[model samples]
Target: MKGLLPPPGAVRLLSIGGLVRTTGFGIMTSISVLYFTRSVGLSAAQVGIGLTIAGGCGIAASVISGRVADAVGARNTAITLVLIQSLAVCGYAFVTSFTGFVIAVSVVLSCHSAAEAARGALVAGLIPAEGRVRARAYLHSVTNAGLSIGAVSGGVALQADTQGVYVGLILACGALFASSGLLYMLLPQVEPVAAPSGRGSWEVWRDRPFLLFAGLNAILAANDTVLVVVLPIWIAQQTEAPLAVFSVVLIFNTLMVVLFQVRASKTTSDIPGGARAMRRSGVLFAVCFALWAFASGQPAWLAVVALLAGAVVHTLGELLWGAGAWTLAYEMAPDHAQGQYQGVFTMSTQLETMVMPVAGTMLILPAGSLGWLLFALLLLVAGLAAPAVARRHTNRHTNRQGTPSWN
Candidate 1:
């Protein structure tokens, strides 16, 4: 049993590291806009524009960092990025002007995106092929737990509403991010795989199949927007369910992921298995959305019932989606360029996230039931396409010689 799991010490360090890092992350995620608008005197429009610019930089940095990870070492690149990110986050405290805010946040977002890609590569190097996805699942649970705690703490700061408290919290978040970098230093380092070919430059961009896979992942990744951005608004304005339903549903979803994410990931051990899990998740998503769609304009009790059912289904779908995405991202990537591959994967989701604020609000918000139905169909199509894409990649890559050892 001991042999089957990651070393206990390694797992313990990783767990503590994830918990601490995301606790800060959770704080910022909930209150950064409030700090900008209230304390810093930046307009909501200014903040949005700044985020738009920063998101673009984040998208670019995702791949840039990955390439850097391959060029240097993943751990080295991760440490450098997070350290720079700490400084950028600290700069947020002084962002009285929109330009200052944009510059600080741009650097912070770039570092965040890059560090994630680098860390992905680092994890690949640290964990065995068979256990990477499971390890990722456990980390997800830990990070979410941290986020829960951070969100609560951020709520306290919000209640305080003083500039000094906000600034103090922001500084503390920067420190936590820096602490995460120190944790990276503590972990045993993974050796950089030597690049043997001249084609090492942006090799992931040239792979057409991976590009398609990445595109599909972007669609699947919308599961995130659906949870955080879209669901609350829809429940508030479109559905007859009480607004409180969203809060409950969110808590339910979080708890389910914290408890069952690793268990669900057990099915997603390999590429074919992951693709299948993704396909199933798509069906579940479609069903969940359908429930929500029909909940629109229903009686309050009926809508509440539908929303709770939808939450249960949505969480299940999310669990499967997380596992599948992790496995596909890890296994399809060649050993030497895990960072590049992960960057591209992360970029897809980042690009989606960057656009989703305006797109989800403008397109999905006003459309009501029809919008939900249409989004459901899009997910269904992506889900159906996943297995086909995975099968094609497998056929193209697998040779008569046997399964490629790199996977």
Candidate 2:
């Protein structure tokens, strides 16, 4: 366990910081749709559109943040973003109209996105390469745990009337950002890696392996978004189960991450098999979708059982794939351009959020089964293709550098 983990102090600090950020993020995300659609009186389609717009803004902010971090230093960049996030949450409380809400949400989302990029760059700066995967896993575990706690607390606060609900939630988010900002301030100053002479974001995009990973990740992210949005709607439509069932499933997922991620991370961290890990994860996700397809036709009780099983499997895949993905990002990135690489990786996920709703909506329409089948096929392709791409890139780099193939 010790070997798999980051140093105890770094782990402790990162965990606490993750806890604060994820708590705020969980509370906000869990309620944003409700707040916008129900409390603020927007239509469902409008809410979706708003989210898409905010996600787009977030993508832009993430890229800009990475560049700013490279220019001004990661810690300073992080602190600035954190402050912006805090103010944005407070702005959420004042959004009385749809236009105001959209603007406010966009601001908040952009700041949150920038903060996330900064956080990733900060992690890359602080942890050694060998310890990075485990560090990311541990950080994710703490985040999941914090999110579980925050979800419950937010539920309680949201049970109050609309005004009270938004007020309470925003206050909680603001406090968390403030706490994260303090933690960022206290972190030991990590010197920025000097930028390479000719590298830029466009050059990073030209790397074939990186592009392949990003493309596959975008697909996986689309599916993940479906699970968040479409699945819940499907469950509500088909089952007598309470809406809280989704929350319970999420709680179970978070619990598994908190309990097992460290151990699972340890086994895989030093394996030098990023591509294989990704393929396995894609297979597992395909299985999850397969289960979901079957469960869609089941009786309510049977559906619940199937959903639970699928959730467990999917969460395990997430743990494995997430660790591998971060490790690959860290490894593939040149030391001098870590921020740019990390930003691009983060951008793929954010891009997924933007694409998911439109794609999921199209799939669930007249040709729903086709949608599922297409999704399954895409995952299988990603599973097969990632490793092949990785090997090809590895061979190319080795040849260019005159290094041993195994290294």
Q: How big is the positional error of residue 259 in model 1, measured in Å on the Cα after superposition?
A: 0.9
Among residues 3 or more apart in sequence or in different chains, the pairs in candidate 1 whose N, CA or C atoms overlap within 3 Å are none
Relative to the true structure, candidate 2 has a C-alpha RMSD (angstroms) of: 3.1
Model 1 Cα lDDT, one tens digit per residue, 36-145: 99988889999999988998999999999998888778888988898898888889888889989999999999998998788788888888999889888888888778
Q: Give a tens-digit lDDT track for model 2, residues 12-42.
A: 6877877888898888877777877777788
TM-score of 2: 0.89
Where does candidate 2 clash, by residue pair? none
What is the Å distance of residue 213 in model 1 from its true position?
Answer: 0.9
Could you estimate the TM-score for every candidate? 0.95, 0.89
Best by lDDT: 1
User: Model 1 reaches what TM-score against the true structure?
Assistant: 0.95
Q: What's the lDDT for all of these models? A: 0.85, 0.74
> Over the full model, what C-alpha lDDT does candidate 1 score relative to the true structure?
0.85
